[model samples]
Target: DPEKLSDAIDCAPRGERFDWLLSVNINGEILSPLMWAIRDGKFALAEYVIDHLLEIRADRHAYYYGREKLFEKHPEVVTVLCSDCPALMDTLMDGLMWHSHSVNQGF
Candidate 1:
Protein backbone atom coordinates (compact mmCIF):
# COMPACT_ATOMS: atom_id res chain seq x y z
CA ASP A 1 0.00 0.00 0.00
CA PRO A 2 2.98 2.26 0.46
CA GLU A 3 3.65 2.18 -3.25
CA LYS A 4 0.06 3.09 -4.02
CA LEU A 5 0.12 5.88 -1.48
CA SER A 6 3.34 7.22 -2.94
CA ASP A 7 1.92 7.10 -6.44
CA ALA A 8 -1.09 9.07 -5.28
CA ILE A 9 1.09 11.66 -3.64
CA ASP A 10 3.16 12.02 -6.78
CA CYS A 11 0.00 12.59 -8.81
CA ALA A 12 0.03 16.17 -7.72
CA PRO A 13 0.77 18.21 -10.83
CA ARG A 14 2.22 21.66 -10.86
CA GLY A 15 0.44 24.92 -11.73
CA GLU A 16 -2.93 23.25 -11.71
CA ARG A 17 -4.01 26.26 -9.67
CA PHE A 18 -6.98 24.14 -8.76
CA ASP A 19 -8.92 25.40 -5.85
CA TRP A 20 -8.02 23.41 -2.78
CA LEU A 21 -11.23 22.52 -1.02
CA LEU A 22 -10.01 21.83 2.46
CA SER A 23 -9.36 18.07 2.08
CA VAL A 24 -10.56 17.72 -1.50
CA ASN A 25 -9.67 19.46 -4.74
CA ILE A 26 -11.98 21.48 -6.96
CA ASN A 27 -12.05 18.43 -9.22
CA GLY A 28 -13.48 16.52 -6.24
CA GLU A 29 -10.28 14.49 -5.88
CA ILE A 30 -9.13 13.54 -2.42
CA LEU A 31 -5.89 14.86 -1.05
CA SER A 32 -2.80 12.71 -0.52
CA PRO A 33 -2.52 10.34 2.48
CA LEU A 34 0.04 12.62 4.05
CA MET A 35 -2.54 15.40 4.17
CA TRP A 36 -5.23 13.00 5.34
CA ALA A 37 -3.03 11.75 8.18
CA ILE A 38 -2.19 15.25 9.27
CA ARG A 39 -5.81 16.36 9.07
CA ASP A 40 -6.94 13.34 11.07
CA GLY A 41 -4.18 13.74 13.67
CA LYS A 42 -2.51 10.48 12.61
CA PHE A 43 1.09 11.51 13.12
CA ALA A 44 2.57 8.02 12.68
CA LEU A 45 1.11 7.50 9.23
CA ALA A 46 2.04 11.06 8.31
CA GLU A 47 5.64 10.29 9.20
CA TYR A 48 5.60 7.21 7.02
CA VAL A 49 4.08 9.17 4.16
CA ILE A 50 6.70 11.88 4.47
CA ASP A 51 9.52 9.34 4.56
CA HIS A 52 8.26 7.60 1.47
CA LEU A 53 7.75 10.85 -0.36
CA LEU A 54 11.24 12.11 0.41
CA GLU A 55 13.18 8.86 0.08
CA ILE A 56 16.27 9.09 -2.12
CA ARG A 57 16.70 6.53 -4.85
CA ALA A 58 19.93 6.36 -6.86
CA ASP A 59 18.51 7.12 -10.27
CA ARG A 60 18.05 10.06 -12.59
CA HIS A 61 14.26 9.89 -12.71
CA ALA A 62 14.17 10.13 -8.93
CA TYR A 63 15.11 13.81 -9.14
CA TYR A 64 11.90 14.48 -10.96
CA TYR A 65 9.60 12.44 -8.71
CA GLY A 66 11.10 12.76 -5.27
CA ARG A 67 11.66 15.59 -2.77
CA GLU A 68 11.73 18.35 -5.38
CA LYS A 69 8.30 17.37 -6.59
CA LEU A 70 7.04 17.06 -3.04
CA PHE A 71 8.03 20.62 -2.25
CA GLU A 72 6.70 21.86 -5.56
CA LYS A 73 3.30 20.37 -4.81
CA HIS A 74 3.23 21.05 -1.08
CA PRO A 75 5.67 23.67 0.02
CA GLU A 76 3.96 23.54 3.37
CA VAL A 77 5.54 20.13 4.02
CA VAL A 78 8.24 21.46 6.31
CA THR A 79 5.91 23.87 8.04
CA VAL A 80 3.49 21.09 8.91
CA LEU A 81 6.29 18.81 10.03
CA CYS A 82 7.80 21.52 12.18
CA SER A 83 4.53 22.02 14.00
CA ASP A 84 2.91 18.60 13.84
CA CYS A 85 5.71 16.03 13.75
CA PRO A 86 8.85 17.55 15.19
CA ALA A 87 10.61 14.20 15.60
CA LEU A 88 10.65 13.43 11.87
CA MET A 89 12.02 16.89 11.10
CA ASP A 90 15.56 15.52 11.00
CA THR A 91 14.59 12.69 8.66
CA LEU A 92 12.81 15.11 6.38
CA MET A 93 15.73 17.51 6.41
CA ASP A 94 18.25 14.78 5.75
CA GLY A 95 16.23 13.46 2.89
CA LEU A 96 16.42 16.88 1.24
CA MET A 97 20.18 16.58 0.96
CA TRP A 98 21.72 14.85 -2.05
CA HIS A 99 25.05 12.99 -1.85
CA SER A 100 27.56 14.45 -4.29
CA HIS A 101 28.86 10.98 -5.34
CA SER A 102 31.99 12.88 -6.51
CA VAL A 103 30.52 13.46 -9.95
CA ASN A 104 27.65 15.69 -10.93
CA GLN A 105 24.92 14.44 -13.20
CA GLY A 106 25.10 18.00 -14.62
CA PHE A 107 21.45 18.42 -13.82
Candidate 2:
Protein backbone atom coordinates (compact mmCIF):
# COMPACT_ATOMS: atom_id res chain seq x y z
CA ASP A 1 0.00 0.00 0.00
CA PRO A 2 2.84 2.37 0.78
CA GLU A 3 4.45 1.79 -2.59
CA LYS A 4 1.16 2.40 -4.31
CA LEU A 5 0.70 5.49 -2.25
CA SER A 6 4.14 6.72 -3.26
CA ASP A 7 3.45 6.01 -6.90
CA ALA A 8 0.19 7.89 -6.72
CA ILE A 9 2.00 10.89 -5.28
CA ASP A 10 4.55 10.74 -8.09
CA CYS A 11 1.78 10.65 -10.66
CA ALA A 12 -0.64 13.21 -9.24
CA PRO A 13 -1.43 16.68 -10.52
CA ARG A 14 1.19 19.44 -10.60
CA GLY A 15 1.04 20.05 -6.87
CA GLU A 16 -2.02 18.25 -5.63
CA ARG A 17 -1.01 14.85 -4.48
CA PHE A 18 -3.69 14.02 -1.97
CA ASP A 19 -6.94 14.09 -3.85
CA TRP A 20 -8.43 12.02 -1.09
CA LEU A 21 -8.26 14.97 1.24
CA LEU A 22 -11.77 15.83 0.17
CA SER A 23 -13.16 12.80 1.98
CA VAL A 24 -10.91 12.14 4.93
CA ASN A 25 -10.12 13.80 8.25
CA ILE A 26 -7.28 13.26 10.67
CA ASN A 27 -7.42 14.66 14.19
CA GLY A 28 -9.68 17.42 12.95
CA GLU A 29 -6.91 18.53 10.62
CA ILE A 30 -6.56 18.27 6.87
CA LEU A 31 -3.25 16.75 5.99
CA SER A 32 -2.00 16.90 2.45
CA PRO A 33 -0.08 14.11 0.81
CA LEU A 34 3.16 15.94 1.38
CA MET A 35 2.37 16.29 5.04
CA TRP A 36 1.51 12.62 5.29
CA ALA A 37 4.76 11.67 3.63
CA ILE A 38 6.77 13.88 5.95
CA ARG A 39 4.93 12.68 9.04
CA ASP A 40 5.62 9.11 8.01
CA GLY A 41 9.29 9.74 7.26
CA LYS A 42 8.76 9.04 3.58
CA PHE A 43 11.38 11.47 2.37
CA ALA A 44 11.49 10.05 -1.14
CA LEU A 45 7.79 10.67 -1.63
CA ALA A 46 8.17 14.11 -0.11
CA GLU A 47 10.94 14.84 -2.60
CA TYR A 48 8.66 13.89 -5.45
CA VAL A 49 6.00 16.20 -4.10
CA ILE A 50 8.45 19.04 -3.74
CA ASP A 51 9.89 18.52 -7.21
CA HIS A 52 6.46 18.55 -8.83
CA LEU A 53 5.46 21.57 -6.78
CA LEU A 54 8.52 23.54 -7.80
CA GLU A 55 7.99 22.57 -11.42
CA ILE A 56 4.62 24.29 -11.31
CA ARG A 57 5.90 27.22 -9.25
CA ALA A 58 3.35 26.36 -6.58
CA ASP A 59 3.34 28.48 -3.43
CA ARG A 60 5.27 26.51 -0.81
CA HIS A 61 4.38 28.54 2.26
CA ALA A 62 2.59 25.55 3.77
CA TYR A 63 5.35 23.05 3.31
CA TYR A 64 8.51 25.05 3.90
CA TYR A 65 8.53 24.29 7.60
CA GLY A 66 7.88 20.63 6.83
CA ARG A 67 11.02 20.63 4.73
CA GLU A 68 12.97 22.24 7.52
CA LYS A 69 11.68 19.58 9.91
CA LEU A 70 12.76 16.91 7.47
CA PHE A 71 16.19 18.44 7.18
CA GLU A 72 16.47 18.50 10.95
CA LYS A 73 15.53 14.85 11.32
CA HIS A 74 17.48 13.60 8.32
CA PRO A 75 20.20 15.92 7.13
CA GLU A 76 20.65 13.97 3.91
CA VAL A 77 17.16 15.00 2.86
CA VAL A 78 18.48 18.55 2.46
CA THR A 79 20.49 17.43 -0.55
CA VAL A 80 17.29 16.43 -2.32
CA LEU A 81 15.63 19.70 -1.36
CA CYS A 82 18.63 21.81 -2.38
CA SER A 83 18.76 20.10 -5.76
CA ASP A 84 15.08 20.57 -6.49
CA CYS A 85 14.57 23.83 -4.62
CA PRO A 86 17.79 25.78 -4.90
CA ALA A 87 16.37 29.00 -3.48
CA LEU A 88 16.35 27.35 -0.10
CA MET A 89 20.12 26.99 -0.19
CA ASP A 90 20.43 30.77 0.09
CA THR A 91 18.92 30.83 3.55
CA LEU A 92 19.39 27.25 4.63
CA MET A 93 22.43 27.83 6.77
CA ASP A 94 21.05 30.96 8.37
CA GLY A 95 17.79 29.17 9.13
CA LEU A 96 19.68 26.24 10.59
CA MET A 97 21.59 28.55 12.92
CA TRP A 98 18.41 30.20 14.08
CA HIS A 99 16.73 26.86 14.64
CA SER A 100 19.74 25.66 16.61
CA HIS A 101 19.67 28.72 18.79
CA SER A 102 15.97 28.42 19.44
CA VAL A 103 16.27 24.80 20.46
CA ASN A 104 19.29 25.49 22.62
CA GLN A 105 17.34 28.21 24.39
CA GLY A 106 14.37 25.84 24.83
CA PHE A 107 12.19 28.03 22.77
Candidate 3:
Protein backbone atom coordinates (compact mmCIF):
# COMPACT_ATOMS: atom_id res chain seq x y z
CA ASP A 1 0.00 0.00 0.00
CA PRO A 2 3.02 2.28 -0.27
CA GLU A 3 2.04 3.17 -3.77
CA LYS A 4 -1.33 3.99 -2.34
CA LEU A 5 0.38 5.92 0.44
CA SER A 6 2.37 7.75 -2.18
CA ASP A 7 -0.83 8.40 -4.03
CA ALA A 8 -2.42 9.66 -0.89
CA ILE A 9 0.40 12.14 -0.42
CA ASP A 10 0.34 13.12 -4.07
CA CYS A 11 -3.39 13.61 -4.02
CA ALA A 12 -3.56 15.17 -0.61
CA PRO A 13 -5.31 18.55 -0.41
CA ARG A 14 -3.27 21.37 -1.87
CA GLY A 15 -2.04 22.38 1.57
CA GLU A 16 -0.53 18.95 2.21
CA ARG A 17 2.87 18.21 0.80
CA PHE A 18 4.77 14.97 0.48
CA ASP A 19 7.51 14.91 3.08
CA TRP A 20 10.03 12.59 4.68
CA LEU A 21 7.51 11.69 7.39
CA LEU A 22 5.07 10.37 4.83
CA SER A 23 7.79 8.42 3.07
CA VAL A 24 8.96 6.94 6.36
CA ASN A 25 5.43 5.90 7.17
CA ILE A 26 4.97 4.09 3.87
CA ASN A 27 8.47 2.70 3.15
CA GLY A 28 7.83 -0.78 4.56
CA GLU A 29 4.66 -1.25 2.56
CA ILE A 30 6.31 0.14 -0.54
CA LEU A 31 9.26 -2.16 -0.13
CA SER A 32 7.00 -5.19 0.29
CA PRO A 33 5.22 -4.64 -3.00
CA LEU A 34 8.52 -4.11 -4.77
CA MET A 35 9.93 -7.29 -3.24
CA TRP A 36 6.89 -9.27 -4.37
CA ALA A 37 7.19 -7.85 -7.85
CA ILE A 38 10.80 -8.96 -8.07
CA ARG A 39 9.96 -12.46 -6.80
CA ASP A 40 7.30 -12.73 -9.46
CA GLY A 41 9.93 -12.41 -12.19
CA LYS A 42 9.13 -8.87 -13.12
CA PHE A 43 12.41 -7.27 -14.15
CA ALA A 44 10.98 -3.81 -14.46
CA LEU A 45 9.58 -4.03 -10.97
CA ALA A 46 12.91 -5.28 -9.69
CA GLU A 47 14.64 -2.41 -11.41
CA TYR A 48 12.27 -0.03 -9.73
CA VAL A 49 13.18 -1.50 -6.38
CA ILE A 50 16.89 -1.23 -7.22
CA ASP A 51 16.57 2.42 -8.12
CA HIS A 52 14.69 3.18 -4.94
CA LEU A 53 17.11 1.22 -2.81
CA LEU A 54 20.04 3.08 -4.27
CA GLU A 55 18.34 6.34 -3.58
CA ILE A 56 17.33 5.46 -0.06
CA ARG A 57 20.41 3.47 0.98
CA ALA A 58 17.93 0.94 2.24
CA ASP A 59 18.74 -2.23 4.20
CA ARG A 60 21.72 -4.04 2.73
CA HIS A 61 20.29 -7.45 3.66
CA ALA A 62 17.22 -6.83 1.57
CA TYR A 63 19.28 -5.46 -1.27
CA TYR A 64 21.68 -8.36 -1.31
CA TYR A 65 19.02 -11.00 -0.89
CA GLY A 66 16.80 -9.51 -3.55
CA ARG A 67 19.65 -9.15 -5.98
CA GLU A 68 20.87 -12.67 -5.35
CA LYS A 69 17.37 -14.09 -5.65
CA LEU A 70 16.71 -12.26 -8.87
CA PHE A 71 20.07 -13.28 -10.28
CA GLU A 72 19.39 -16.93 -9.45
CA LYS A 73 16.02 -16.75 -11.12
CA HIS A 74 17.13 -14.52 -14.03
CA PRO A 75 20.77 -13.84 -14.62
CA GLU A 76 20.16 -11.01 -17.06
CA VAL A 77 19.40 -8.76 -14.14
CA VAL A 78 23.08 -8.91 -13.26
CA THR A 79 23.86 -7.18 -16.52
CA VAL A 80 21.44 -4.44 -15.64
CA LEU A 81 23.16 -3.83 -12.32
CA CYS A 82 26.65 -4.04 -13.77
CA SER A 83 26.12 -1.92 -16.81
CA ASP A 84 23.54 0.55 -15.64
CA CYS A 85 24.60 1.09 -12.02
CA PRO A 86 28.06 -0.17 -11.46
CA ALA A 87 28.26 1.84 -8.27
CA LEU A 88 26.20 -0.84 -6.61
CA MET A 89 28.98 -3.35 -7.20
CA ASP A 90 31.41 -1.07 -5.47
CA THR A 91 29.10 -0.66 -2.55
CA LEU A 92 28.58 -4.39 -2.31
CA MET A 93 32.26 -5.05 -2.56
CA ASP A 94 33.01 -2.56 0.15
CA GLY A 95 30.50 -4.20 2.40
CA LEU A 96 32.01 -7.60 1.69
CA MET A 97 35.45 -6.36 2.51
CA TRP A 98 34.28 -4.83 5.74
CA HIS A 99 32.53 -8.03 6.70
CA SER A 100 35.60 -10.08 5.86
CA HIS A 101 37.77 -7.82 7.98
CA SER A 102 35.34 -8.04 10.85
CA VAL A 103 35.22 -11.81 10.68
CA ASN A 104 39.01 -12.11 10.53
CA GLN A 105 39.34 -9.79 13.49
CA GLY A 106 36.84 -11.80 15.45
CA PHE A 107 38.66 -14.99 14.69
Candidate 4:
Protein backbone atom coordinates (compact mmCIF):
# COMPACT_ATOMS: atom_id res chain seq x y z
CA ASP A 1 0.00 0.00 0.00
CA PRO A 2 2.80 2.41 0.86
CA GLU A 3 4.62 1.56 -2.31
CA LYS A 4 1.53 2.06 -4.36
CA LEU A 5 0.74 5.33 -2.62
CA SER A 6 4.29 6.54 -2.90
CA ASP A 7 4.29 5.74 -6.57
CA ALA A 8 1.10 7.65 -7.00
CA ILE A 9 2.48 10.64 -5.19
CA ASP A 10 5.71 10.45 -7.15
CA CYS A 11 3.99 10.11 -10.49
CA ALA A 12 1.41 12.82 -10.03
CA PRO A 13 1.49 15.57 -12.62
CA ARG A 14 3.73 18.53 -11.92
CA GLY A 15 0.85 20.89 -12.61
CA GLU A 16 -1.03 19.37 -9.70
CA ARG A 17 1.22 20.72 -6.99
CA PHE A 18 -1.77 21.38 -4.80
CA ASP A 19 -2.42 17.67 -4.73
CA TRP A 20 0.65 17.25 -2.61
CA LEU A 21 -1.21 19.05 0.11
CA LEU A 22 -3.74 16.27 0.17
CA SER A 23 -1.02 13.68 0.44
CA VAL A 24 0.72 15.57 3.20
CA ASN A 25 -2.47 16.21 5.08
CA ILE A 26 -3.82 12.68 4.75
CA ASN A 27 -0.49 10.97 5.10
CA GLY A 28 -1.99 8.22 7.20
CA GLU A 29 -2.75 6.45 3.96
CA ILE A 30 0.84 6.19 2.82
CA LEU A 31 3.30 6.75 5.64
CA SER A 32 4.80 3.36 6.36
CA PRO A 33 7.54 3.41 3.77
CA LEU A 34 8.45 6.88 4.82
CA MET A 35 8.60 5.97 8.47
CA TRP A 36 10.51 2.83 7.74
CA ALA A 37 12.91 4.75 5.56
CA ILE A 38 13.52 7.24 8.32
CA ARG A 39 13.88 4.57 10.99
CA ASP A 40 16.33 2.66 8.85
CA GLY A 41 18.46 5.78 8.41
CA LYS A 42 17.36 6.35 4.82
CA PHE A 43 16.13 9.86 5.38
CA ALA A 44 17.97 11.57 2.56
CA LEU A 45 15.54 10.52 -0.15
CA ALA A 46 12.50 11.20 1.94
CA GLU A 47 13.85 14.47 3.32
CA TYR A 48 14.88 15.63 -0.12
CA VAL A 49 11.43 14.98 -1.53
CA ILE A 50 9.80 16.56 1.50
CA ASP A 51 11.96 19.65 1.14
CA HIS A 52 10.88 19.98 -2.46
CA LEU A 53 7.25 19.70 -1.48
CA LEU A 54 7.80 22.40 1.12
CA GLU A 55 9.44 24.56 -1.50
CA ILE A 56 6.47 24.13 -3.81
CA ARG A 57 4.15 25.27 -1.02
CA ALA A 58 6.50 28.11 -0.08
CA ASP A 59 6.48 29.45 -3.61
CA ARG A 60 2.78 30.05 -3.13
CA HIS A 61 3.48 31.98 0.11
CA ALA A 62 0.12 31.44 1.77
CA TYR A 63 0.06 30.42 5.41
CA TYR A 64 -3.56 29.29 5.49
CA TYR A 65 -2.97 26.73 2.73
CA GLY A 66 0.73 25.96 2.64
CA ARG A 67 3.00 23.91 4.93
CA GLU A 68 6.36 25.74 5.22
CA LYS A 69 5.79 27.36 8.58
CA LEU A 70 3.89 24.36 9.79
CA PHE A 71 6.85 22.14 9.04
CA GLU A 72 9.22 24.65 10.56
CA LYS A 73 7.13 24.93 13.69
CA HIS A 74 6.49 21.22 14.06
CA PRO A 75 8.79 19.00 12.07
CA GLU A 76 7.93 16.07 14.29
CA VAL A 77 4.29 16.59 13.49
CA VAL A 78 5.01 15.70 9.90
CA THR A 79 6.25 12.28 10.86
CA VAL A 80 3.35 11.68 13.17
CA LEU A 81 0.67 13.04 10.89
CA CYS A 82 1.94 10.96 8.00
CA SER A 83 1.91 7.70 9.86
CA ASP A 84 -0.85 5.25 8.88
CA CYS A 85 0.03 2.61 11.41
CA PRO A 86 -2.15 2.59 14.48
CA ALA A 87 0.66 1.91 16.93
CA LEU A 88 2.65 4.76 15.50
CA MET A 89 -0.41 6.94 15.51
CA ASP A 90 -0.98 6.31 19.17
CA THR A 91 2.63 7.08 19.98
CA LEU A 92 2.62 10.20 17.87
CA MET A 93 -0.68 11.39 19.27
CA ASP A 94 0.46 10.93 22.82
CA GLY A 95 3.67 12.82 22.23
CA LEU A 96 2.04 15.56 20.21
CA MET A 97 -0.80 16.04 22.68
CA TRP A 98 1.66 16.24 25.54
CA HIS A 99 3.81 18.71 23.66
CA SER A 100 0.82 20.82 22.72
CA HIS A 101 -0.45 20.80 26.27
CA SER A 102 2.91 21.91 27.55
CA VAL A 103 3.14 24.73 25.04
CA ASN A 104 -0.37 25.87 25.79
CA GLN A 105 0.33 25.78 29.51
CA GLY A 106 3.39 27.89 28.92
CA PHE A 107 1.32 30.38 26.99
lDDT of 2 by residue, 13-43 (tens): 5334434411235799765655565556666
Q: What's the lDDT for residue 62 in model 1?
A: 32
Q: Model 3, stretches more than 4 Å misplaced?
A: 1-31, 56-107
Q: Local distance difference test, per candidate?
A: 0.59, 0.47, 0.40, 0.44
lDDT of 4 by residue, 3-87 (tens): 5445776675554543452335444554333444446655454443344344433235342222543355446754553553333
Looking at model 1, residue 3 earns an lDDT score of 55
Instruction: For residue 88, give model 2's deviation from the true position in Å.
Output: 9.5
Off by over 4 Å in 1: 1-27, 58-65, 98-107
Worst 10 residues of 2 by lDDT: 15-24
Query: Each model's TM-score, in the order given?
Result: 0.55, 0.33, 0.27, 0.32
The pairs that clash in candidate 1 are: none
The total of clashing pairs for model 3 equals: 0
* Cα error, candidate 2, residue 93 (Å): 12
Model 1 residue 73 distance off true place after TM-score fit, in angstroms: 1.1
> Who wins the TM-score comparison?
1
Q: How much is the lDDT of residue 65 in candidate 4? A: 27
> Which 10 successive residues of model 3 have the least lDDT summed?
14-23
